[model samples]
Every structure is written in structure tokens, then in C-alpha cells.
Target: MTDRSDAHTATTPLAGRRVLVTGGTTGIGRAIAVLLASEGAKVFVCGRDAQHLDDALARIREVGEGDGITIDLAEEENVARLFEAATGYLGGLDIAVVNAARGAEGLTDMSEADLRYTIGSNFTAYLLSAQHAAKAMGAHGENATGQGDIVLIGSMSAYVLGKESTVYAGIKYGIQGFAIALRRELGKKGVRVSLVEPGLTGSDMVEGTSEEQAERIDKEEMLRAEDIAVGVHYLLTQPRRAVVQQVTISPRMQDEE
Candidate 1:
């Protein structure tokens, strides 16, 4: 639709919109769902874990209006099913948040399975989801303003180098390229594609870390999942005439390596 608000309430712009978020059962996706619903959106979320999906749905219901589905993005057929189900649930997809991601172990520990799983779950999923979202949003013709949005959640690791993050970085980097190319191709169709890159957010993905390491890394100073959700709302709320190509958010206190 249109984003008319300032920084104080960027999410207010998403009111009355229909949005679908992948991997929304926890972490950043869950935060995006909650914030979008609070802003008056009919949000739909998907995740592979049924229990997690149910929990996320309950939490969203408690806070606002939304639904959740269980589907593994790694499976192409499942990805298709998710879009179909989400379209029906949301009454038509107006916005898509591609947040599904999986981590790969260190480069030394990497195997064919790890590489395939990483790419399949992260990069490939976004490509497929964007393909589906573009079709669904384009099918709606144009809103009164003639536009829709597809936001891909990328990572700072996409461009950075970390000893153990090589494979994961590759996936995130691939997503960046995917979003940029997709945006160019879809611009004529009035479906804007954007990339949101958030750095170091607190989530279950890092739950395995020790408290000492967590402190050393200063998780407290890292970007919060809700913060990225705010960014997603901002990008989607922009007027049809405006497009935010990409946004990178990190904790002010975190140093770039």
C-alpha cells in the first residue's frame, strides 16, 4: 500500500494489508508476524515444525490476528503447497517476507548434504517463494496504486567473512543476488522486491552457545528480532512509487569484521 508514517511508527503503514511470512514460527519471522498483525494485517506464517508453528500461531492470536502453517521449505513441492495454502488463507498475497533460513556447519565440517540443505532451505526457497508471490500478487492486477511487495530477509554475513560462517554466508549472499535480479525483472510488473539484511539477532539458532561466548559476543548489543520486523513493515508500507532496494540493520554496538 503506502507508507506515510515516520520512524516512530513505521509499522503503522501496514494496516489492513495481507502478508505471508516463511519460517515465522520463531525468531525474526515470528517478530515480523506479531508486528505486522498489530498494525492491522492479516498475517500468515509457515514453518517446518508443527509444534513451533502452533505455538507461534497462539502467540500471534494472543497479540493480534494471524494464522500459521507447517511446511518444510527445503522441499520444492512443500514450498508450492505453502504458497497455495497461504494465498487461500490470506485471501490473496499482497506481501511476502522470505525469512526461511538454515545454517551450515563450518567449512571443514561441510558436506554435500550440508551444502544442499543450506542452499535449498535458504536461497532456493526464496527464489521459489518469490516466483510464487509474484504470480499471486500480479494476478490481483494492481491495487488502487498498482503495486505489491516481496521482501527477502538476508544477512550481514552475506558479505562478511567469518571462520565458521562460509557456507551460511554463501547462501545469504546468493539471496542478495537473487533479490536484486528479481527486483529488476519484476519492477515492470508493479511488484517491488526488496532485501532486508539484519545482523546478529537473538534467536534459537544461537541457543547452543555458552553464556560466556554469548556475553563475549555481546548478544545484548545485537539487533533484536523485533527491530528487523519493524524494517520489514517499513519497506512493505512504501507507496507504489517508492522502492527501498535493500536495508541492513545491526546493533549499534556491534563491530563489523
Candidate 2:
């Protein structure tokens, strides 16, 4: 039996790993950045908002030294620039956490403009980031341990039924498909791709919910940002011989209806 306790002891299983996290300035992405840095990975994070990016960079620096960049992932050129920045700052990449996404409100009332922006930010951005991350990690070759890992943050909403979630679910489902296909393609190259799905976590995304509705959802019972961070750490820390292809985490009290 594998000892999970030893796996997360403070000795830093990620000591020398070079990592990049998209949407790393807030919410789940920010939590992930902090956790990865605590484990000693040299972490680079990016976001589109300059003020938030600066704040996140300052907080992350308090934890450890890592680079942060401001880029709109929906733009191909910006995506390319992000990769270049990470390469220059970190020298190379070993792990990538794709955690950026936007929540669209009111599907029935949403404009086409809203739909386009939502998909572009949530779905296209993830694909673009992954493409660049794969290229960067591929260039680095496998580490001495012969493993490269990518963790894509997905949503339980992809599979759950919800009002006004048409675009969000669609994009998340697309990410699931992308992860499976990417894993198949990269497996041979020693790059393991996986998805992390968390249910109704408390974050900026949930602020849109009404107090009554949010309480009924039992947000307290739902997974926290750091909870998902622990999952990310677990997925990346596995021995080279093993791969956790997908992880679905929900509140123990969460019931599917």
C-alpha cells in the first residue's frame, strides 16, 4: 500500500519542478499557486488583470520566488507571449495547471457577445494554454524521472444539471474531451495529462449566487479552493510509474439530484 502521509510531508516532493499556472491570480488558481510553491516548485502564474496579477505576484513572492505575467489567454499572440515569458523566467516547464475560466450568468438572457466572450475565455484559453505548455514541456524532454505532468482544472458542472449553465457546462465538457485525447497523445512522450473536477467550491464564481440559493447549495459542505489544491498536489506528486488520469472531488454531503 502506498503511504499517502509520506507523500505530502513538508520535505518538498516538488522541490525542483518548474511549474506554470494559468488564471493563477485569484480563486482556485491562486490557492493552487500557493500550495505548489509551499511544496517548493518554482511556480510561474499568469492572469489578464494587471492589478490582480500584481497582487498575486506579491503574495506568491511572500511564499517563494516565481514569475507572474499578465496576458489574455484568448489571444493567440498573448498565449505565445505567456509561454515565452515562462520559458525565460523559469528556464523550462515541468508542470502546468490550467485553472482559468469565466462563469457566464443567465444563459436564456445572455447575448451572443457574452456567449462568445465566455467560450473564448473559459474554453479556448485552456486549449491555447495547454498547447503552449505541451510544447514547452516537450522541449525540456522528460526529467531524470521521465515524467511531465499537466493538471487541467475542470468543473463538476460539466456533468451536473444547472440553470444558466449551458456555456459553462459545454466548455467544461470540451475540456474533459481534450484531456482524454491529450493524455493518449502525450502518454508515449512521458507527459501525463489529467483533469481535476471540483463541485461548487466557494470562490469568486459563486459570488453570483444568491445568499439563500448558495446556502441551500450548502456551500459550507462544498470543497474549498485549498481542497482542490491538495488534489492538484496529489496528482502531480505521483511516482513516474503511475498516473492519476482524473480526479473528481465533491463535498461529502453533496447529493446528485
Candidate 3:
């Protein structure tokens, strides 16, 4: 019989792996960073708020090892700097979670400035950051084999397409399409691309007091941010030969449109 014991295993271990999590100082992003750290991954995260960055890094350090910075990803130059800093800190990248985004109001209710910021931060940032992450992972380079992982954080807004969420839904729809194309573009180069869409998750993005959010979670009307984190973890920990192309996690009791 063949020496099957010496063969490579299907599961990708997280121990000592280098990870980059954008928008990781709050909500789903923060939860992902902490969970990866707990699993022995060396995490690097970024956020717009310095306080949140400190808090996240502290939590990660309490579990494993981590570092991070504060910067607004909407600016292209900042995105470049973020990758440079992240790779420098982690030595090299093995996984990247692109989760930085801002919620947008209704089109008619939004000011011109708000509209531009929403598009720039939510859509443009995701694109630019993913581009940099792919290059960092050596995608399209020779000798690539299971090079790395990229998980984009999308939203159920894409499918829901509810009123007052025009810009948000449009950006999420763009992300869904982008993930499909990106997986094909990078697959041959050994980079895996996946998307995780959360439905009605309780986070800073949602408008509610902590008590209200907790009540919603208790009622099963909304998902905890950690629920989305678990979905992200599932995508990252899969076997090398498989890629979970997309995962949509919705609250069981959430009324569907």
C-alpha cells in the first residue's frame, strides 16, 4: 500500500500563519481577527479608528500575536500603505480578509459628499485592497500552488435590495460579481477567493443601542457579529483542493423580502 500517512492533509492549519484583516477593529472584522489569533495565527489588522485598533490588537494579543494600524482605506494611497505595513509586520501574507466598509443612506437622503465617500470606501477600497493583496500573495507568478486565501466581506443587501439601501445594495452586488471573476482570475495562480455575506448581523453598522442589539439577538431576529466571524473562519480553514465560493449566513427568523 502507498504511504498515505506522509501525504499532505486536506485541512489548512492556521497555526503560525500570517493574516491580514482590514476593518478588523470593529464588528465582524474584529471578531474574525480575534478568532484567527486564538487559532494561533499571527494577525495584522487595520481600522479607521485608533481606539478600536488598540482594543482589537489588545484582544488578539491576549489570545495569540497581532499588530495593526489606523487608516481610512477609502484613499488609494492609504491602501497601498496598509499592504506595505501589513506585509512588513507579518513578513508575508497567507490570508487576507477585506472587510472595510461604511454603511450608506438612501440615495436621495445622502449628500454629495456622503455618496462619494460611500462608493469610495465600500467599493473602491475593496477593489484596491484586494488587488494589492493578490499581488502580495504572488498570484500569476511562477511556482504557485495554493498560494493564499482572500475573503471579501459582502452583505445580504445585495440580494435583499431593500428601499433606502440603493448604494449599499449596489456595492454589495458589485462585490458578488467581483468575487466570481476574481476566483477565476486567481484560481490558476493558486490564490483562493471567497465571499461571505451576512444577513442582519448585529454590529456597529446597525443603528441600535447595545441592549436593543442584544434583544434582537436573543429573539433570533439578528445574528451576532461572531456568527459572521464563524462563517469567515469556515472559508479560510477549508481544504486546499476546495474553495467555498460563497457563503450567505442569515438569521433564521429574519423576515425575507
> Among these predicted structures, which one has the highest lDDT?
3
lDDT of 1 by residue, 143-255 (tens): 32235788999999987778888888877888888888988888877888899999878777764454643574465566668889988877877667778999999888777
| Superposed Cα deviation of residue 47, candidate 1 (Å) | 0.8
Q: What is the TM-score of each candidate against the true structure?
A: 0.87, 0.86, 0.94
Better of 1 and 2 by TM-score: 1
1 or 3, greater by lDDT: 3
Task: Show the colliding residue pairs in model 2.
Answer: none
Tens-digit lDDT string for candidate 2 (1-257) = 77797655433278878999999998889989988887778989998789988888888888887879887776658878888998789998899899888787767778988888888889887888887787777723443223578899999988986777777888889899999998877787778899999987877677555565457446555666888899899878777767789999988877766
User: Which lDDT tens digits does candidate 3 get at residues 90-125?
Assistant: 999999999999999889999998899899999999
Considering summed lDDT, which 10 consecutive residues are worst modelled in model 2? 138-147
Off by over 4 Å in 1: 1-12, 139-146, 207-220
Clashing pairs in 3: none
Candidate 2 local lDDT, residue 8: 58
* Reference-based TM-score, model 3: 0.94
Cα deviation at 79, candidate 1, in Å, is: 0.9
Query: Could you arrange the candidates by TM-score from highest to lowest?
Result: 3, 1, 2
